[model samples]
Target: MRTQLSIPVTALAVIALAACGAESGPGSGSGGGTVQPDVPVAGVHWTVDSLTVDGTRTEAPDGAHVEITDKGRARGNYGCNHFGADVSVEGDTVTVRPAEMTEMACGEKVQNFEDALRAALTGRLKAELTDGRLILTTEKGDSIALTSQQPAPLVGTKWVVNGLVLGDTAASLPAGAQDKAYLTFGKDGSVRGSLGCNRFTGTAEISEDSIAFGRLASTRKLCDGPEMDVERKLVKVLEGTATYELNHRSLTLTGPDGEGIAAVAAEIPGEK
Candidate 1:
């Protein structure tokens, strides 16, 4: 995700965005009314409910993630690399920071997915951060939304993985399989983690409000450690539950009914 712009627009985003779905942007999202195509400004997050990438229209968890920080501090993940960009916000006028990213190769269509997402975030976007949720939008009614849910406080806490849904189908990690999953939420939304295995990141949108998730990203090292079973079972469990609750030292996950499941993860030191 290294973006050293030769300038802005066209050159940098155009090519990068092309790899993302059928759209090409590296486009811009923070521009004015007269802002040209694929150019953006900084510090403005628009609010649109639905969006279409390339020719596909995705609701629910298939939306966007945007951030316009206070200290030129902006960062987000477009279902891909956690991105860091420069930004400037003035009244209602918004501008984009010179955006850049870290280079971590992933097997999922993450690299391509990011390119398309960045491209669509162009032209005078209007955004709102309400109740801790950040929603930014595009002219075509496209949108990127994010909720600030960080790692929950660890220490004496119990948790569980309920279910895992990839797209629409219910994917089970199986009972005998050593897999595991966890739930993390923010005022904005929720992120069901796949431990160290394949984890999916998605949110529920206006009408397309359904649970969404993705694959896991971790070090490519093969080990037969005990955590390996936790990783495997965690994934299976996530695909079973629809929702969960976390307490000081416990996590309870409700599956298709009130009789769901729960687990107490040994809160890692400093896992807040």
Candidate 2:
């Protein structure tokens, strides 16, 4: 289960706060009082939980999340497509400019959810922070609920390959190869997984910024072209030392020539 933030407010402080309410006396303008700190919204991995609009609540898909940086950048996935936008925060208001997103064809359900999320995240929003949750409400009363969470650790995570990265561009896996390749890193300096066609196990030297994979031994198996294509690409990434980045539940391993594979942390069955 996710953890919630706790803040203790004393009775005397509450009483004093009430007493410092607006004054009706002459020339009593807004000036001095205990100013509450703005909510810490940046640099946190926010898992979008749901969107509430017109009294209806819709739960977000498994991988929907948003992360805002202090450098005026906002990047996140809306169910299927990943998006980025320029954002500005003033007091408790967050203004999001129009976002640029990837053009991926999605199923009906995911497309609908993505459209709703895209619409709700635009323009200026009032931010309300309570416990560990952050709610961003649009002027028309629509709201998006999100919860904070730490990034998934590299080791012990089931990373399922979702796309291939060549240089700076990301491309989807070959047809019929989706969800067929996966990798898991072990604490005992071992790595093992399916290569979409064959099963392999090998040693790995993991450091703070890179992973050095040893020669992998795999079972001899024949597969179709699509599967073989995925296996070959993954093999390239698994060879030699590769730098890695973990963004929320997403993982990217890039080889020396900037070729790599992108994966996501998949839930192990019966482990959640």
After best superposition, candidate 2 residue 240: deviation in angstroms?
A: 2.9
Runs of candidate 2 exceeding 4 Å displacement: 1-42, 50-63, 77-83, 88-93, 100-115, 124-126, 139-142, 267-271
Identify the leading candidate in terms of lDDT.
2
TM-score of 2: 0.69
Residues 1-272, candidate 1, lDDT per residue (tens digit)?
47721102211221222222233344433331222223222433322233456457544222123443334454543432345654443433244445676453332344455555666655545554455344555566665544433333422232444233333222223343222555454335445444644444444221122233343334454435544555654544445434544433334444353333334343434554
lDDT of 1 at 171: 27
Instruction: Go through the candidates in order and give the clash count of each.
Output: 56, 0
- For TM-score, the strongest prediction is 2
After TM-score superposition, the amount by which residue 230's alpha carbon in candidate 2 deviates from its true location, in angstroms, is 2.0
